[model samples]
Target: MINSNSRSVAALVALLVATAMPAFAQPPASPAVPAAAVTSDAGVSGTAGSSRDAARARRKANRQLVKRVAAVLARTRGLDSSRILIRAADGTVTLSGTVPDNMQIPLAVNAAQQVAGVTVLRNQLRIGMRME
Candidate 1:
């Protein structure tokens, strides 16, 4: 009689486990992302691409301005551009690096200011040896 009771309890426990197995195997429902959220994400990606393109164009323009300024400085009388560095933004120019003579500092500033695209000039030139 005790053996039969033990067998019945074991069967009941097995049944409960068998019923619970399917619930554990199936995945729970996941909330779907909103359509507007997906659209905004795509828009943001496009904006980022356009922003990068704009930044690249600006850098190219700045480089062109620097080259123009450098050429002008090279053509100027008694100004050595070998040790001078030129950087340009929208319309602002920064002249850095070394010049052999103090007089050349003003010469560089004047030449850079005359460039068509240069609306502002920052003279950071120092009288020193060539910087490698």
Candidate 2:
């Protein structure tokens, strides 16, 4: 049996390491979590039999990237208010669904292009398709 003092110290060290490791704390989140997992009402269409918790976390991270892309487009190109939808898979952002106009599409693509952690931009956007 170990001494109580030494055991406590070991536990404390473990906690410190866990907390200090930002990479461990912020692993890749889900692809459907929405702008800020804690806030966005976005839902996941994850693969069957997948862990809900893991999927949600993954989506949350993707949503954050989507949010940044949207913000960048909105500020730089004035196009975030459109119907363009964005999703991320391991830093590759795919813009899909629909948008307001042809101009908005490229603007959105370029916006996603500028964001950090974005490896590529896949435009699945159908120009002029209503997103109702």
Candidate 3:
């Protein structure tokens, strides 16, 4: 006659073998994904490419804003823009570097502010002689 402990051991072994059998079995073959559905780069999808393009476009727009502001300052009478440096991001513009005349500082700021697409203006200009 089979003892209770021996029967319990036999049942536990059978349960373990039943559960572990699936781990050794080969998995079912999966359908291949179409080439058009796959992205150029591994682990990256189409959204990453679109976002990269968007970031590039934003940088280009910022550069264009800086050029327009610099042009405006250059065309402004009594304002010397040669010594000034302009930086733009989004709609914000930063005016840095030194101006020969104190009056030209306001002229630069005002002219930059009047230009379209300039939402914020940061004036880092100082009154000093132009270096070199």
Model 3 lDDT per residue over 1-132, tens place:
569889988987785575446435624322344566546775676766776687789889989999999899999999889978887878988887778888999999999999999999989777665434
lDDT (10s digit) by residue, model 2, range 1-132: 569989988987785565346434544534454543353233533432255566667778878887887777668645744656666876888776556577777777776798997998887765453423
Give the worst 10-residue stretch by lDDT in candidate 2: 40-49
- The lDDT values for all models are 0.78, 0.66, 0.80
Q: What is the C-alpha RMSD of each candidate to the true structure, in Å?
A: 29.1, 20.1, 27.8
Candidate 3 regions off by >4 Å? 1-44
Sorted by TM-score (best first), the order is: 3, 1, 2
Q: Could you tally the backbone clashes for each prediction?
A: 0, 9, 0
Best by lDDT: 3
Q: How accurate is candidate 1 locally (lDDT)?
A: 0.78
Per-residue lDDT, model 1, residue 43, is 52
Error of 2 at 110 (Å): 1.2
Candidate 3 clashing pairs, residues 3+ apart or interchain: none
